[model samples]
Target: MTKFDEQYRDLVFRAIVDGERVVDRTGVGTRKLFGETMRFNLQEEFPAPTLKKLFFESAKKEMFWIYQDQSNDVRLLREKYGVKVWDEWEQKDGTIGHAYGYIIEKHKQIDKLIQGLKENPHGRRHIISLWDIEELPYMSLQPCAFQTIWSVNRGKLNCQLVQRSGDLGLGVPFNTAQYAILVHMVAQCAGLEVGELLHTITDAHVYDNHVEPLKEMLFRPIMRDVKPQLHITNRTQNFYDFLPNDIRLLGYDSHPQIKLEVAV
Candidate 1:
């Protein structure tokens, strides 16, 4: 198991043992902690949790839908990539409205981000945010892992993801590995080496329905001897050129997937 898997297990344990039980917007409720952070050195190994299987293909396709496709159409995601995670939130017009990819496309955020990273590696202003207060009302669901800050150090590229809220059981694992892959892709496009991925969550919680399964995950034996790694097969100089097949995960051994309910 990766250090991240250990940390993830610890975080879940903390929530069960020390988190406050509270009602949330979902009505499913949560055992929540106010603030939490996880850091991974991309140079050592990938940060995917192995206690339960991660849907790597789905996560990769979703990331592409958000950044590369920059599309708000959930139908396109389903038809093109065979990913239906966003279908639950698909609006009447067959889209997620002005959330996520819409905002990115509108503001040309991804283009500017890639350009900024390439031109000014040491620039402190490298940031991308999906939370547009004005457009929030039209969105089916606001971006959860919404902001990213990029920094370059000693020929390495690092990313800090700031999430306003994270569902500990489901969303956290996907976001953790998803963003790590993003960092790797962006780093490659910028002609830099992989460095670190730092994730910060303002409100991290496990829904009431997920506590037991998470407990089961925490107690399961971890494959400590196995090491998981991420491989980027595409050397696409532009981040937008990346396709779902361009990335691959190697040495990912894990237990059976644990089913959990999404509070949405």
Candidate 2:
């Protein structure tokens, strides 16, 4: 089993077996665990989930929309990438408001991140935060995988994602793999080797409606022999220039996607 598969299975199992039943903002109740962490060595494997097929391309597009394009326009995602993942969160003005891309762009976080990693590989201050306190009221939905702290050691880039909430059935898979790809992209642009991706979630939950699907996902067999590897083709050294097509997941074999509803 891949590292992601093993860890995800354990998380789902624990959330169902030992978690507390609680009411949430979504109206859909959840079996919640207070905190959880997963570590992935990018050099060992790409950490894509093997039990269920990951929406890699759409996820990549969303990541680019947030970090690279630095845009909050939901229309652009729908029109250009044919991805409507954020459509449910679209505000009246055709944006998700001052969340994600808007905050990143406003602070020039990505630009500073790359510059920091390259200029001072040993710097302790590399971070990108999406949880802007003042912009919370304007956002359609608050950022879940909210912050990333980066560090470079011995020519390798390491990243830690601090997420406030994690919807185990839908969001966690995407967040873990997508951010791992981000580490690869950022490390490439910063001229460093890919290292570890530490994912820390403060509240990890399994929505009541999604429990069955999560169970099914856990029951599915993991493709233990296949090693998932991420391959990236860089046309430019700039991180902002990367498109979804430039990245690919090789040897990624998964079971058919288990349908789960997004508790919007």
Highest lDDT scorer? 2
Q: Which stretches of candidate 1 lie over 4 Å from their true place?
A: none
Please provide, for model 1 over 166-261, each residue's C-alpha lDDT reduced to its tens digit, 9 standing for 90 to 100: 888999989988899989988888889999999999999988999888889988997887678898887888887787888999988888999997
Residue 29 C-alpha lDDT in model 1: 85
Tens-place lDDT per residue, model 2, 1-264, is 999988889999999989899999989999999879999999999988888989999888888988988999999999989999998999899999999999999999999999989889898889899988999999999899999999987788999999999999889999998899899999999889999999999999999998887888877766879789999976467887787998999988888988989898
Error of 2 at 187 (Å): 0.4
Question: What are the TM-scores, per candidate, against the unseen true structure?
Answer: 0.98, 0.98
Give, for candidate 2, the lowest lDDT window spanning 10 residues.
233-242
Model 2: CA > 4 A from native: none
